[model samples]
Target: MFKAVGKYVRAVWYLMTFRIDKASESLRMNPGVVSANYDRIIEEKRGRINQYKDAIAAMIAQEQQKKDKLKEVTAEIEKLEKLKAGAAAKARQVAAKYSGDPTATRNDPEYQKCQTAFSDFSSTLAEKQARATELEADLEGLVENINRHKLQIQTQMRELEKLGEEKHDAVATILSAHEEKQIADLMTGLSQDQTSEELRELRELRQKAAAGARVSRELAGLDTKQAEAEFLEFATNSQANDEFDSLIGLTNNSPETNNDGPESTRIPES
Candidate 1:
């Protein structure tokens, strides 16, 4: 409440003190009616502005969640992209490793080496394709939500613009109701919208900030980690039944093994 009051004083103090005199002088206005009317306007404006600030804060909270989701999805996307690159690199290496020497059937030592590499690359590629598809779908949904929020904010601003001074009169009616039903009349006269104009303005400011937002690009580096992990995971999966003696190198791939700890999970992945 105090913060809202501070903001109100800063936003309208000049108008109330300096500009109001000019308005009264130019119009040869009735000071008494205007002062009474002005009191209501100030209250409504202060209420509305505070409401706007709260709404904007809420929007920002929602946006932060969405961005976190975006980061997760983007991380997955880079992981897949890196997996794609690794799959191709491994494919070339495997073909080269298995090729040049004829008579080396799948049972030959070198042939077995190349065969395992080829299978790992193919499996990693498949996983990459699936994760990339999921990441794209999540990104599309986030974009839709962002657009919906934008439309809502624009509509709110237009409604606020239409409210004008009608709200002030309504507030006056509320505080000054008489035994003759003046309060009831005032409450009836003030529309819900008149009371909410300030809330809308705060939301608009948040929307503007959101619209200018951009995705961070450094997250693209997740590809290398993704590729390496995918290869390790495939090795782990295949070796789960193998006597390869290598222990299927997936220790680095599990969530439990992350530097941030298992409690890192938060927003939905994009």
Candidate 2:
């Protein structure tokens, strides 16, 4: 019993699914529905593309930031190098003051101050240079990524445009197919369309109406009256023809001149 119940439920589910699918298919095939669906899809794609563009914009912004940072780092490195060179120049002048006294040059407070300054500058410059190198690499990567994304966006835009064209073509093709199907159905005499049925009913009604009119005419003795009129017209035309024949000498006597009968001949003397 449980197995049977399960089977029954399964069958019902399958039937429902089938019906839903069939209905969906029919709805999708409608021209207006098809167009609306395409529009919806296009809108969705456009929204997604906009989101993608936003992301690309962010990357471009990041790329610019990296470039700015790299420029700043390079400038700082140049300044540090200049400061280090200045420190070395100051140390040389101090050492020249001690002409031949090497120990005095090493112990000189001014020379020692210049050496310390140069060492600090050298360390700072090296650090800045390393940072500049890192920024350059990051900027290069960002540029490459930005360029690739731009290409992708261009391709997507083209695809979007093509989708627009496809929408029209799809609608046209479906409309044409519908028209052809209707014609084929009509030709095959298998069309069960409501409009076709209505047209047939209208024609039937028209024929019945004509037949009723004929019946009504017969019932009202109008047909007899028409026959009587025709007979009268025939008699009038025959009389007119006789008169014309007599005037043209085609008949021996006109009804108006020989109403009595044949005329008698007169006899002479002898």
Candidate 3:
């Protein structure tokens, strides 16, 4: 009778464990549970990604504005530098012309002209120097801001990386193989979309920057030509032979004129 009772107890214990194992397996493989958990994880990751994307976009916009302003300031600074150089050159030429004449007095028309030109050049140089200083300070501030933005971007990227890792961990822990694969594919698709958008924006920015640079270069070229022409005209009117020759030399050595030689003058190699 005791043996029979022992057998009955062992049977009851085995049956309970079998049911428990079956229930655990059911829980693990349940489609509803897996789907719900997968969705939740994906949603959370997407939310974080969207937040990061928005932040990055705002930063990029701000950086672009700063870049544009920097470009403008740089171009202005370049123009001011050229103007200052021209003024100095003019002052030197005037001084040299007057210096060659020992009989020239302060009251002489040429002497008076030299003094006036020197005074104007000095004043203009001082003004431009001050403006250039201000622009340099502004450029430094913009650089700092750009650096800050870069740091912010780095932080955002790190956060995104961490979030990605967390997403993978969450998926691995809660999802079945099929569900994990689906979520992975979805994430890949979303990532591709984001990458494409970023590429498009970068391309657009590059094109705009290139266009702006081209326009700036063209304007600079025109200004340079105008300044050169004006200087040459002043030299001619003043009968400053040496300065006129120097200006002519500069014109002759210009890339445009130098490259305009006859295309048919090629020597054939024997």
Candidate 4:
């Protein structure tokens, strides 16, 4: 029931349905319906495309800042750990020096004093080392999290770029069945003038699709010059059509046909 057109189509379905006959006639003769549809699709695609790009940029800027701070925290943890190890080694050296003194009592003021101080220092150093290890682990985890976020952002951006207009058009292919019927009815009852208009719309759509395809290809950085060449070809064709149409209008009020000769051309005759 709801799997044919799109939001835009859904919103305007009534009008389209009401004028179905007229629209159909216009479409058959000019194909302007195709052009209008293309315009809607392209507009939708461009909006989504920009949003995706902005999301990637925002994620990079915001999340990368947090990751940089985590790096600094890791470095600080390492430095503190080295200091703790040095304190432990120095305390052991003093204990060893006093151990060799046979005349010294284990309970003597000096030995006991040194022993008390060293034990306290050792405990403090151990605590610092433990804290540093925990901090290091947390920092490493943070880095991994940031990397995963970065990868996700990049993947989405690439997919969006790749999918482009095709994906967007596909998204909108869910209009009500009634909408299809309405459009069909319109197409069947269209007048010659209306049909010509529809045909014209279709021709314009073909040209835009051709150009948009080129732009998409250029974004992918692949075979771009070919797209440029094709666009140039279409532009030249359209200009020629304009001139031919003017001549036909002056010579005979009737519309000119097949100026481009091949069915491939979009603009009217000449």
Candidate 5:
């Protein structure tokens, strides 16, 4: 009589904990409502992620344009500097040619021509030098702007990555909750026989997967053997072809013999 009373008490506790309390909780937290909320959160996060990605792409494009502009400015500066150097050299040559001659005055046509050429070259050189300096300053400004944009993009990317991780974790949590709720519902509704049948079906699926894996491994082995056989056959054929070619060349190079009659009737060479 005492053992029967103890068994009845345990059964009541099991029913309260696993069935009644679980049903109460399920009624309190509706699966449809929870799923809707999770979907909304996911959609909002995805929109933010797309916005950040688009901003980063725009920043990258702007940075590229700035870099191209800087390159152009630098090239122009280098070209101007080269031209200035050539102008300076020509001025020096002209000065040297007209130097140490006290009789050669401004009245001399050659000296005047040399002076005009040197003056024009000097003017052009000074103009180019000033333009190069301006371009260098512009290049420096472009570099600074590019660097600023890069830093901004990096910060945004870090934030975007954090947001992505958070979204993934949220999705995982929501999915886990959903699966748990589904399993609880299944347990509440399914009979023992039905549960057993489901387990047997799952076991069969596992067996099929195992068999498929075995077949895949066998097929892979057969493919490897086929490749090896093909390689060996190709090597053997290549070697035979090479030997045949050598034999043919030797036969072709051999001296031709006239066998019109027997050896006694053949003409003898002097």
Candidate 6:
């Protein structure tokens, strides 16, 4: 018994769920509901697009920052190049002062200072160049990524437009299909439409009204007085017809001028 009760409860739940799902599906098929659902989807997509734009904007800003940093590094490298050239020129001047004495030039503190300055400037320029190269590579990657993201955004926008068109088409198709189904149902005599039912009711009423009128007219004709009146009218018409025939001399009558006699044999004047 317990098992049976549990099964019954499960069946009831299943039936309820099925009914709810069917009702939901029916409501969802409505044009207004479908349109609203599409609108909601569009709004969600727009929100996502806005978020994507924000992210792209951030990437662009970072790319600009990298570009600015690369510019600064490039400028520093140039300045270092100039300083190294000047240091080499100063060392050459010191060597000229040595007048062919290589050992004296090597020991000269001024020459040593020039050498150290050039070495420092060269190292700093190399470091700045490397930094600039890295920044340039970073900028290139960022630009490519930004471009790809922009293309994706454009594609998504086109998809959104397509979705908008699809929404309209879907609604129209659903409405047309619903109308067609109603017509088919009506043709098959399966329609439960209130209008169809009302029209049938009106037709029945009209038929009843016509039948009632006919019955009323038949009952009136069945009246004895009516039949007598018709008979009297027919007699009067017949009398009028005979009088008209007499006036036209179309009636054969016994001549009053005929000789008064019952004799079968009477000589007639030729």
What's the CA RMSD for each of the models? 53.3, 4.9, 50.9, 29.1, 33.7, 6.8
Give the C-alpha miss distance for residue 120 in model 3, angstroms: 0.9
TM-score of 5: 0.35
lDDT tens per residue, model 2, 142-232: 8998999999999999999999999999999999999999899989997779998898899999999999999999999999999999999
Model 1 agreement with the true structure over 1-270: per-residue lDDT tens digits: 999999988879876867888976645334346456666655676577667667666766666765676576567656755665665565455556667445534346644655565566557657755765665676567567666766766676665555545555554554454323544555686544554667788899888776554222225655567688999999988756443323455353543334365556566679
Q: In candidate 5, how many Å is residue 249 off? A: 99
Candidate 5 residue 110 Cα shift, in angstroms, is 9.6
Query: How well is each residue in 161-209 modelled by candidate 6, as lDDT tens digits?
Result: 9999999999999999999999999899998999878998999999999
Ranking by TM-score: 2, 6, 5, 4, 3, 1
Task: Output the number of the TM-score-best candidate.
Answer: 2
TM-score of 2: 0.83
Q: How high is the lDDT of residue 139 in model 2?
A: 86
| Candidate rank order under lDDT | 2, 6, 3, 5, 4, 1
Q: List model 3 lDDT by residue over 135-212, tens digit each.
A: 567657766765776687577667657765665665566556656666677677743446667888999999999999
Q: What is the C-alpha local distance difference test score of each model?
A: 0.61, 0.92, 0.67, 0.63, 0.66, 0.91
The better-scoring model by lDDT among 5 and 6 is 6
- Angstrom error of the Cα, residue 114, model 5: value is 9.5
- Candidate 2 error regions (>4 Å): 234-270
What TM-score would every model get versus the actual structure?
0.32, 0.83, 0.33, 0.34, 0.35, 0.80
Off by over 4 Å in 1: 1-103, 169-270
Expressed as tens digits, the lDDT of each residue in 1-270 for candidate 5 is 999999999999998889988887775456455555556665776676567667656655765665676566556656655665665565455556768454554555655665676566567656655765765676577667657766765776676567656656665776788787668876886534576778989999999999998799787797678789999999999867766665677434222232233884668999
Ten-residue segment with the worst summed lDDT in candidate 5? 251-260
Clashes of each: 5, 0, 0, 34, 0, 0
lDDT of 1: 0.61
- Give the clashing residue pairs of candidate 2, or none: none
lDDT of 3 at 5: 98
Tens-place lDDT digits, model 4, residues 131-200: 6566566656666665776676567566556655544444344333435656776689643457668898
